[model samples]
Target: MTKIANVRCQLVDLEPETARSDASQSFVKQETVLVTVETVDGMSGTGYSYTIGTGGTAVVAMLRDHLVDGLLGADARNVEQIWQRMVTGTRATTVGAITSLAMAAIDVALWDLRGQRADEPVWRLAGGAHDRLPLYDTEGGWIHLTCEELVRNALAAKAAGVRGVKVKVGKPSLTEDAERLAAVRDAVGPAFEIMVDANQCFTGAEAARRAHSYESLGIAWFEEPLPADDLAGHVRLAAATTVPIAVGESLYSSLRFAEYVAAGAAGIVQVDAARVGGITPWLKVAHTAESFNVPVAPHFLMELHASLACAVPNGMYVEHIPQLGAISRGGHVIEEGWIRPPESPGIGIDWDLDAIDNLRVA
Candidate 1:
């Protein structure tokens, strides 16, 4: 048995090349909490989770003062056992972000260690359902961009062989959102898919109103229109429109997603691995969606999410938002529109330790 010998955490502040803005908030920077786990067998694995800007220090503290201690001396290959131990040990914070993110970092590292020991990539280890997944671009579709900007970016993604572009909605008027989407649709033509994201900026009533207008433009899905907690609201909104309702990023547990799925509220499950208590629950949620015959197009951390996405049969698209480009030594291969999973064992993030070390805050 490979015994875990050590666990470490670091806080790094990463600024986006361009600020990202959606209807509800602006991401001026990201604070990533990077975690590393080493086993007695001379093998180590790295994993990470992040906050938009704040609360990273709390995640760092949680890892150092709390989660890390529990992990030391455990069997590195017993991922599920370790995961449950971490979750139950932190029962007080179980339903919140800090506990979930902390668990995610450690749980992912455990999985990474498992993959490395077996000399297999995480996708195959997790369950290889597909070799590649189609890409969707969200970089150029932020709410701050103008119609002309939207068209230019959407066409660029299409030219790059991306299957679709997700434009941020929640403009002052439904007409305004429709006009911008229309501009993108007209620019890309009917061949390229157009999705819309509101980032939880709408009420159930407002979401339903906008969903109708979006449907007229042939949107692929209406994402996070209502807040993540409003399962009944989402169900009402879903019944009111033909466009699929996508959620799960803000949700912190697998049971929450099961509730959403069981209610027939979420049509596309965008389970963010970090937010859902790491790969263990992420897998549970993905399979949960599969049982319901719903497609999963998980949230960010594209590098790692690509592997997870390709692992499950119902996995659909991996959001092509490259947040780790500045700190990572390498990136994923996007050939024609689909992303090919990294052949390297474990999660594919190749940290330039020098760069990451320079930005380390804890």
Candidate 2:
């Protein structure tokens, strides 16, 4: 039986090439926790998870000092058991970010090892529902962009054959946000989709007000319209507007997602694999959404999400934010607004290890 022989975790800090901003948060840099798991038979798999800009070291330290020790002598293929062990071991922090992020890094590495052993890609192993997924561009729609810039970028994306572009909402004036969306819609025409994200910047009343105006512009969905924990607010927002209320990236647990799904609070579930504790739980959340007939449009980590999005039938649009451009070894394919899952065995991220080593800060 293959057994986990060693585990290592390190921190890497990657700066964005351009400034990114939403209503509530600004894009500074991304801090990822890289994890490597080696089996006794001399095979190794790599996986990682991230924070938008901070807490990388805490995740790495949790993996190195606490979570890694728990896996010694355990069957490397027993992903579920290992995930539960990590969850139970870190009971104090299980519902929090640091613990979930640490567990995600390890869980992902374990899945990579499993896929490598089978000589199959994770998408196939997980259940290949589709080989190609539609892409949506978020990089071009940051809150700081002028209305002209927004229209220019949306038109550019349309020219490139992308299906949609996500615009940041929550400008000081609702009229400004509306005008921007109006310009983009008029530029891209009726065929192109425009998604709006508020990044949890609104209260129930405010989100309702904006959602009403957004619906008139034919937005595809209203993302993070209300705070993630405000399930009632989401329900109200979902009811008040015909626009789909998309949420999930800010949520930390499958149970939390279950609550949202059960309440019919969200129409699109934006499950982030890193935030949801890796591929195992991410799939659980995805399937959970499927059970409720809600579509999953996952948050960042495009390189990895492209595979997961293809693996499930309920998976929808994959957010296109090239955060790993500098560190990714570049094997996945994108053609005419569609992403083809990597054929490589495992999660398909070919990290430049040397670059990662150089970027490690802790």
Report the lDDT tens digits of candidate 1 across residue range 275-340: 888999999999999999999999988989999999999989999888887789765788988998
> Which residue pairs collide, candidate 2?
none
lDDT of each: 0.90, 0.90
lDDT of 1: 0.90
Per-candidate TM-score against the hidden true structure: 0.98, 0.99
lDDT of 2 by residue, 143-170 (tens): 9999999999998898888999999999
Q: Give the runs in model 2 whose Cα sits over 4 Å from its true position.
A: none
* Angstrom error at residue 141, model 2: 0.1
Compared with the true structure, model 2 gives a TM-score of 0.99
